[model samples]
Target: MAERSEEVKLLGMWASPFSRRVEIALTLKGVPYEFSEQDIANKSPLLLQSNPVHKKIPVLLHSGKPISESLVILEYIDDTWQNNPILPQDPYDRATARFWGRFVDEQIYVTAMKVVGKVGEEKDAAVEATRDLLKLLEKELVGKKFLGGERLGFVDIVATLVAFWLMRTEEVVGVKVVPVEMFPEIHRWVKNLLDVDVIKKCIPPEDEHLNYIRARMDRLKLKSV
Candidate 1:
């Protein structure tokens, strides 16, 4: 029998897509962990102690050793566990998957946040940038069921995180970067991704997420006024 340990801990925030990414990865791997919800605004002592540098949520602690960064944590989870493989076996395919994963971080997530956080012309520009990024993703998904072709892989995980945040931002900002008619491929991808049992259950309640973003946007609006 394999040695069973009970030392895995995940520090996360409810509204954070990064946190969701880590949670999904762990759940997919069937790794048992204790989840500690962190108040990012208040900053928990345990979170600060575990991730002294970034002091960010979504920190994974295995046997008391903490690891920060969602992508790095995903890689860690995939590498440490052998039962459910998240990455591809072929080196070239793995690199492609990693490229798309990084692309989601750099393009979709970065642009979507900027779009939601800005006002007037800046906000319009950000929306345009996000639309362009989504168009690119649409092209990428032309003939694929998932980013890894058939199965949900690393790139799919990253892309799903982007979609989750983007959807919330759209509700809060009262703008649609991903117009369903314009980007049929991405719309299809979003529907497919959300249909997955784990993802459907793992996503934060939609109304709750929307309310959270709306509150933040209202605060920003008040600050500007």
Candidate 2:
């Protein structure tokens, strides 16, 4: 692999939001890179070796060096490419962007996962927690067209799934995780972002994405029973 040092590759999964994030950022920046679709369940040796810590997809292999974690990869892409400028330029603004980036990935993303795969009191608590955290994001998007302003940036890219994926997840599970009536601002932001031709192209087809979610939820429900 030594000769492949200069080559850029992304190990990803079609259904993975993390993978989707890196793909969108790369496309937006006009960076050329090869993509290797990973079978997440079967796992790949390269995926394991690249991300030994978490053993996850969306690992960026740049110049033979591996970068793990989707949020971190997004920043690395921004810094390395430097053309499109994913983060805000001002010092305070950049820090604020990163701050919100972390908040979405940590607080909101984690809680959103809990909305699925649980039942009764557990599901209720998860729904409440996820909704409460989303309210914070709703407040964050109160004034901005995108999380980072007029353009999609770190926060917006990292939050790709928090809105889109959750929307589909809520539908498949028949839950109210992202009630449009309650979080108008966030939903509006979602529509704005997805409406973009570039980003829209990166997303999986609606029927395919929904079917994937529905099948996964069905499997989870069966296991629970």
- What do the candidate models score in CA lDDT, each in turn? 0.82, 0.86
- Give a tens-digit lDDT track for model 2, residues 1-225: 223324889999888888998989988877778999999779999999999999988899998899999888988888877888999989999899888888888888788788778879998999999899889889989888998888888888888878678877888767888888999999999999977876897887889999988888888778878
Q: Relative to the unseen true structure, what is the C-alpha lDDT of residue 159 in candidate 1, on a scale of 0 to 100?
A: 79
Candidate 1 overall lDDT versus native? 0.82
Error of 1 at 108 (Å): 2.0
Query: What would the per-residue lDDT of candidate 1 be over residues 1-225, giving only the tens digit for each residue?
Result: 022226788999888888888888878877788889999889999899988898888899998898998889988888887666888989998888888888889877877777755779999999898888878888999988877678778888877766787866776788888888888888788888877887886788988988898888788778777
**Can you give the TM-score per candidate against the true fold?**
0.93, 0.93
**Clashes in predicted model 2:** 0
Separate clash counts for every candidate: 0, 0
